[model samples]
Target: MNFSEVNIGLFRLVNDLGKEHEQLNIIFTFLAEYMVFLLAISVICIWFTRNKESRIMIFCATITFTCAFILGKVSGVFHSNYQPFVELSDVNKLIVKEKDNSFPSDHTILFFSYCFSFWLFKRGWWIFWILLALLVGISRIWVGVHYPFDVIAGMILSFAVAINVYIIVPRLNGTKKILNVYEKYEGKLFQPFRKTKGSKTRNY
Candidate 1:
């Protein structure tokens, strides 16, 4: 099958699966909406880690996500793709229909960009982050809003931006200043990772 055919077939399969159970719909919807907040939680937790490396990586991740979002927005202006519900007849849309461009799933880009940042930096919990990102992407598809190629494109963009961010940020002269400021106030937060009994706290 051609790429577009496979994409449509996968969308139909997931849409059909979504109809099989209300519980599954609830689960996937939750993953699609709220799971992106894991990025915020991750950054907050990493801030209190008191590990200089991880703290620096979080700063890089911030830049990565910002750039990824802007890139997605610019792509939307140049390349338009309608939501499946709008383009296709009788789609089983589980989420509220969005009128915005759907060529590169924004939620997928957000989730995968943050997760790919961890992967690029060799940070902790990258595997978990990747799995969560996958779930969120699949949920977007299952909800009948995004095509499979949208998710794939989001991931590809995410990897490119994330890897470059991790690599380029450390080399920038301003990045060292930012990292220094971050480290200066690092342990002022509730650092649960500090040693309590002479043993280093485990990195989450």
Candidate 2:
């Protein structure tokens, strides 16, 4: 049918899937909630490394996250789409109800924006980050708080923001200056945590 009908249909399909098993519900909910923490930890680890590539990555991610957040907030002002649980009669909402705009899922936008920004640079392990981002988006729909279209829009906007940030950040002279400063001081700041070369760990 039309786009709204399609949205409802997909929402029903995945929302029902969540109701089929308690384990799936728990798994999806956990993924939606905690996957961002994993991404944050990754950013922190990358920040500590302080190499050129890591510097560029963290910079792009920082811009992407900021743009995504601003766009998400602005989207709510223009289009306030209600949650599926709010509009539909029977929704298996595994997560807590949210009354905010659902047109573009904020969680999806933030995580996917970060993951996609990194993937634009590094081509290997970032693939897992992309998949994790997809899983997080799907989990939002599965939990019945977001319509499929909401998640899809979030992904589309996130990719757009990430690509723009990736392209634009490297061209700025200030980026190089800040990165130089960060690299210069990173070793001193983390000296206590730095491991010696050729150090061996004892096995218990």
Candidate 3:
């Protein structure tokens, strides 16, 4: 009826994969976390490839990521703690016991945030990231920390944030200053949009 039910069914599907090997399990978790950073970085790079709209979404990611990290550190003390390690047997019943908090999932936030970035940039390219994003979401439950609901919440939150940034932000036109800067470098790399637009490329 609700999101958790769907997550329960979803997580159950891959419950078998958790049985493979300890090494593989760790690999899944590691990859999930790593992929978030990779996609986040890619979003930042996209600023120059497209236009003002593109860069705005990525800039939101940079800000969101920083906010998440800072909040985790602050929240980690009371609502959460340092999870140094996890054992194999505890994989099931991950949500009720081991993981912290139900409202927001850092992994979900991180995963969906990146997913939104790529999806906006190129739908085809976005598909690959989406698959990787789901895999990463499952890995959290597979390793025993996040519930399906937690991931869903995170993903939903991330999706909303990205959408708001990409769509609503532009409506404000307050982003014009930054968009102008990005538009200037529509075809270059590692350079600010402003500088690229200002440079002379050929003889007049």
Candidate 1 per-residue lDDT over residues 1-204, each given as its tens digit: 997789788888887788777678888888877877767787888866767788778788778878988898888788788988888877778778758689888888888877888887878888988898999999998888998888888888888998888878888889889777766676545355456533543433
Cα lDDT, all candidates: 0.82, 0.84, 0.60
In model 1, which runs have C-alpha deviations exceeding 4 angstroms? 1-3, 182-204
Q: How far is candidate 1 from the true structure (C-alpha RMSD, Å)?
A: 5.5
Off by over 4 Å in 3: 1-16, 21-23, 48-53, 60-89, 92-99, 121-124, 181-204
Clashing pairs in 2: none
Tell how far residue 100 is off in model 2, in angstroms: 1.7
Ranked candidates, highest TM-score first: 2, 1, 3
Which has the greatest lDDT? 2
Off by over 4 Å in 2: 184-204
Count of clashes, each model: 0, 0, 0
Q: Which scores higher on TM-score, 2 or 3?
A: 2
Give the CA lDDT, 0 to 100, for residue 30 in model 2. Answer: 89
Tens digit of lDDT per residue, candidate 2, span 32-131?
A: 7788888888888877664678768888888888888888888878877789988998899887875767888988888888889779988438889888
Write model 3 residue lDDT over 1-204, tens digit each, in one string.
775466556655565566765557667767655666776567656754665545665666655555554554454455432221232343443223453344456776776776676576554377887888888877776756665665666676677667655565546655677667655554355456646555755322
